[model samples]
Target: GIGDTIRVSLTEEPEFEIPVAKIIANRYNNRKQKHGIKAIEKNPLHPFEYSKRASKEVVGIGGKNAPIVVEHDFYFENTATDKLRITELAKWKTDADGFPLFTFTDFAKADKISTQANFVLMNLSDFDTNWQDVLAKSQNIVLVFESKTEHSMAEHRRMFIELINNDIDLPVIIKKRYSAISEEVFQIYAAADLGALFVDGLGDGIWIEHDEQISQQRMINTALGILQAARSRITKTDYISCPSCGRTLYNIQETTARIREKTGHLVGLKIGIMGCIVNGPGEMADADYGYVGAGFNKINLYKGKEVMLKGVPEENAVERLIDLIREHGDWVEPN
Candidate 1:
């Protein structure tokens, strides 16, 4: 279904050559007509507000904290890998016996669970009619899910929707396990699965379990990247650049590279690099700063929606944009 939607959005009609924007609009309108207004009214919480509320109910994950990136301890059991030492690895809290503090138990076995542990981990299937009694003794609950089918994202989303409908505000750690896949495939699969959840404000943390083939650092970085792309977290500089076209006035690729090279360390800053001003402002409406092509060898810089400098020479635009950032007290020294 999604593949068809994507294909239609990119392919031009043979007869009329309809705009991509209009095609998307028509598709959206058709869906609305099919589902009716009740579909829109059924959402219980706004996406932004949903995450805010979910964060508050969990301990150590409250006070408006960004969604955390959790590292699984799969490496600890493997003695062959010395790539990341135990001391340097990012891990969860452990008991004095070197065991995890929380207990991971199946839903069927939860009836005999003890309250000695502070945290309890359960699968989506653990949620049942008597779930309230089973979880009543725990200080915190962490829901975990793993898909058994190709529609993993949808299954994860449905689990979240069930929680919201039942008013279960426990923190959820979106966990996915991978093996026998290339690093590139893992990256795409993991991002598509977890990013879908986070973008809709569904997850409280992310936990990726993988074989030793994937480095520990790569997993950590992928988790952070997914959160950053979802706008749920900001751990690095964010660049919003358009694909250059006939309207472009300069080498957009080289310019974007130069801009990123200088400002890549400025965490939380959003920079938009546009080939032209036609759709630049509207496209990057949420960007904190913008560098748009104005005319031949000319540039325009904007702070928010307001243009701070107009018709700046292309040679001096990047530095001027940096200066503008400093003037606004948003610039920090690169470490």
Candidate 2:
């Protein structure tokens, strides 16, 4: 299965290329799923519980902190090449000696394990019973899983299940590496691969690495997007908009864009933009604010499920929505 391939030809150039590794990896992952792995019988603890159980407190990571994004040191230390400011990137924790506090090592290499690091990262693939003693000695250790197999997400899930079964509640970080793929494909793959673990309450943080082809900013945004989608962390405005249809009124797409342009800076706020009243109120039940089409050129604004204003002209709806956010003390001037 790992040797499978299909040929692709370009009509103009009369040249062909075969993506042997991609094909084999996809097939291998698919085949591995035919026989299901054991389900997680024990219900894992809430993310907050795991954080509190951590031996040491690290700001923005573990110990009642929201899940964090860990970027490569180059993005933070090498400011000359990376135009983005350090404040925009992930923050690194350092020891009193001015060295990085986290140590990443393969579990297979017993001699390489670090004893001084505050946060130690060990691979899940090379797990052995002998490492249990090492784990017991470390008070501030964080397991990091980077699956070598194509079916990585599944393997990560399996490792989490094993940890839960054995009563190990050490904070875990999901690590993924990508290369030789377009930026769009990388985003989709990273979200699906890492978001699944967060959805299961299995990971405490996320670490993403990509080849030089992808920018550092893109990688940071992607990590934040995955966390936001999982509902585990909130760093930006969240929008719930409906697909336009026959019943739609006003310019749904244009209105949504305009609303986002104004309110995108409102962090952790859920805004709903719906085409019509039929499904608007019901769909955005959890949204903080809602804008729905009340009539041909009229809009209805809502604060939660309750309607705060009705029959407002469509032209003035965006301004009125801003007023509503301000009235509730949620508005902040865009920086």
Best by lDDT: 2
List runs of model 2 lying over 4 Å from the truth: 1-60, 74-119
* lDDT for residue 200 in candidate 2, whole number 0-100: 65
Q: Show where candidate 1 strays beyond 4 Å.
A: 1-3, 7-59, 72-121
- Minimum summed lDDT over a 10-residue window in model 2 is located at 81-90
Alpha-carbon TM-score of each model against the true structure: 0.74, 0.75
Local distance difference test scores for all models = 0.67, 0.69
lDDT tens digits by residue: candidate 2, 1-335: 63364443221122212343344345455666464545566745553343222323332245555676777662221122332111211133222332133333333333433343334555553455465666666555656677644566877877776676677767776888888877876886787688877776667778888899999889999999999988888889999887656687788878988999999999999999987899889988999999998889999999999999999999999999999999999999998
User: Per-residue lDDT for 128-199 in model 1, tens only?
Assistant: 446666555554554555554445566677666666776767767677887877786677678877897888
Q: What's the alpha carbon RMSD for model 1?
A: 8.0
